[model samples]
Target chain A: MKYCSHCSNEVTLRIPEGDTLPRYVCLHCQLIHYQNPKMVVGCIPEWEDRILLCRRAIEPHRGKWTLPAGFMENNETLPQGAARETLEEANARVEILDLYAAYSLPHISQVYLLFRAKLLDLDFSPGIESLEVKLFEERDIPWNEIAFQVIRTSLERFLLERRTGAPVFHTGKIDRSPI
Target chain B: MKYCSHCSNEVTLRIPEGDTLPRYVCLHCQLIHYQNPKMVVGCIPEWEDRILLCRRAIEPHRGKWTLPAGFMENNETLPQGAARETLEEANARVEILDLYAAYSLPHISQVYLLFRAKLLDLDFSPGIESLEVKLFEERDIPWNEIAFQVIRTSLERFLLERRTGAPVFHTGKIDRSPI
Candidate 1:
């Protein structure tokens, strides 16, 4: 940040009193701007034997297949954000189930919370941010074209655990080292 | 926010094209500033039959007891952030276990991620933000003085699930309605 959003004054980076990390503090207002990891919430929108996927029409991995997900917004619960993203991306309705997996991607300062959701019906199509929306069975999933490592791993685990007739929460981290 | 941090220009809130929600957009740079919920992470530190708690020395709930937690920072995993909070608040080193509970407090735009943790040793003391740090058994917990509702609910569930021998992930929402 170059200037304070509060006072329109220049901001300086320094460790605040009693704090260990350097934060952007406004020179005039002394307001501290703290940045934290954003959450990307989505769901494994499952039907009887298939799950929904969206081909992104936006950047960062445009045109690749992905779970319907995006940066969660303020004032919404995780499940609400997940379902909203699904509606926005795939025009699909889902009953959000148990959180399937959470992966902290420190590289991008994001936490991915992917839930297992019951796809309500087959009445679905692409929203504005998607090129196409389709359901893929296990064997038909385009593993190599998955947009993100977190999604790929979560999908893999979700499919594996389905055989046991129960799904549990999983958590892990994905990091891309600094060059 | 009154000013844009990117270009020190006046900002106006408007729903950007293709966005359902309004965002602060810079007049000069056309930069969109999006705000999202932050994650607060900590753990239920287990020491055999007891778990740890810290009496707050900070403002929001000074002198009341709470689990060690704070806003998660960048470049860290959820488990790492939880463990860091434990160390910083209670001087307690812990091996963070499975995430036991997640709560979204939409009223304040925060998500609480509490994990089950193993307290490593007995050498623990209050950190700067704590007035005192101590371990308490289930029956001795100061339920009435717990700092936040999310913490209270997570603790109650944690204690109840202990007898079942398996801890599954639990998720919910807590909202304090606006006056």
Candidate 2:
């Protein structure tokens, strides 16, 4: 936001009239530019009581296991984004049953939304971003090798609720001490 | 991300041999930076069959109509994000019913996830980022003056489903032509 889109002039950071935080405001057009965090949508897709997990072929945590997820695209809805990511990474079709989780990481400037989805079929193959795709039983999850804390937490909660028959909705900030 | 986080050495973006896209490769520490898109979550909360909407108090569409939404925060889940935003802007509490839409807009570099939330209570007021808050019946919706296309489309689909009793899940790209 070095230049103002409205006025085509150089912008400066300043606290508006009575605002607390500094914001980029155009001197010419008086427009302010805001840089907001993004959204990632994915799913804990289940097939006959098994959860689908994909081994990453890409970096960050390459070869680590995670549920199929990706950034939401423009114009598509959240379920569409989740479904697309599932299809792209696991070659799986799923019907979204519920939005189970929404996570925000202010440290990394990201928000993750995970859905509880039901697999339409048992067939799946690893898509381009995955080294392999497989379904994991409750006790067989690779807890130590999960790609992100969010994935690990979501899976843990999912498994726990399945066992206890009491689904808990957790809302608040996550402690990022591990990552 | 062209510097090593571990060693503070120069890095480069490259495709390792047969890779399809470039990734940050740190030569000194052998670290690879994998960047993923962030997530934005929001909700179209319904009250007594009417949908909740807010007038933006901030730019780029200040004074325009939009559903209460914001990027997911670090300690919250998607449903929590939507609920938080609903609470923040509309001063209302909601129970998320279903994932109504998911989309990615490459043009704006954003992925938006919207949920169809059921308003838990009717008491409401405008919050910080909103100029005004109100609920509108299907025919009373200010369609032409909506802030974002995504909100307009979501409201349209929501109203349509209410009337037709048929589910609408949009997966294709939204036409962004000027109205």
DockQ, each predicted model = 0.88, 0.15
**Top TM-score hit:** 1
RMSD of each: 2.0, 7.2
Deviation in angstroms for A99 in model 2?
A: 1.1
* Per-residue accuracy of model 2 over B61-176 as CA lDDT, tens digit each: 89899999976654456677788888888889899866667665544555667887888887989988899999898789888879988777777777888798954444323447
Best by lDDT: 1
> Against the native chain B, what TM-score does each candidate's chain B reach?
0.96, 0.81
Interface RMSD list for the candidates: 0.6, 9.1
Backbone clash pairs in model 2 (N, Cα, C under 3 Å; residues 3+ apart or in different chains), count: 31
Clashing residue pairs in candidate 1 are: none
Residue range B1-179, candidate 1, lDDT tens digits:
99999999999999999999999998789899999999999999999989999999998989899998998999999999999999999999999988988899887899999999999999999999999999998899998888888888888887887877766788999896311
Lowest-sum lDDT 10-residue window in model 2 chain B: B170-179
